[model samples]
Target: MQEFFAMGGYALYVWSSFGISLLGIVYLYFEARKYHKKQQRLVRYWLHRQSKKKSS
Candidate 1:
């Protein structure tokens, strides 16, 4: 396993790169969900307003 950990003396850098990529993916996922919810809310609001206007 020593050879595996060595990774040609670049284990630390390789692991750090993988960790940063994972964090970026997680951040993007939450941001995308928030954006989708906001869009849905805007659509619902517009539909409600249209219906109200039609009734008047």
Candidate 2:
């Protein structure tokens, strides 16, 4: 109810901290995915180069 939202008169601090933590988690998730994609691309590129070298 209202009391839950108010959070014992510390709603601003509590909610802001919670929001910041949520944003941080979301940012980390996207960053990790981006890093994973970049690593995959690098691996593919490395394999391609290795094959080229072997063929030569």
Candidate 3:
């Protein structure tokens, strides 16, 4: 267990890298969701405007 944790004395580097990668993945996930919702809203707005213009 200790050996695994130590990672042959490279534990700090290994752990830091893993932590950074995890943070990046989490950030990307949230950003993607936010952008997706924004895009949907824009599309809906545009469609509504087009319909209104056609009616007028």
Candidate 4:
């Protein structure tokens, strides 16, 4: 197991690369969630306005 993690003495580079890739995926997930929520809010607001206009 230790030898597998060592990666022939390139552990630092290998682990850092893996960490950065994981961070990037997490960041993208949060960003996509934020964008989705914003779009949902916009759609709800538009629908509300249309309903109000129809009632008026």
Per-residue alpha-carbon lDDT of candidate 3 for residues 3-52, written as tens digits (9 for 90 to 100)? 99999999999999999999999999999999999999999999999999
> Candidates 1 and 4: which is better by lDDT?
4
Screening candidate 1 with a backbone cut-off below 3 angstroms (N, C-alpha, C), the clashing residue pairs are none
| Rank list by lDDT | 2, 4, 3, 1
Cα shift from native, residue 55, model 2 (Å): 1.5
Q: Would you list the C-alpha lDDT of every candidate in the order shown?
A: 0.96, 1.00, 0.99, 0.99
Residue 28 local lDDT, model 3: 100
In every candidate, how many clashes are there?
Answer: 0, 0, 0, 0
Show pairs that collide, candidate 3. none
Query: Looking at candidate 2, what is the lDDT of residue 18?
Result: 100
Superior by TM-score: candidate 1 or candidate 3:
3
lDDT of 2: 1.00
- TM-score for each of the candidates: 0.87, 0.93, 0.91, 0.93
All candidates: CA RMSD in angstroms? 1.4, 0.7, 0.8, 0.7
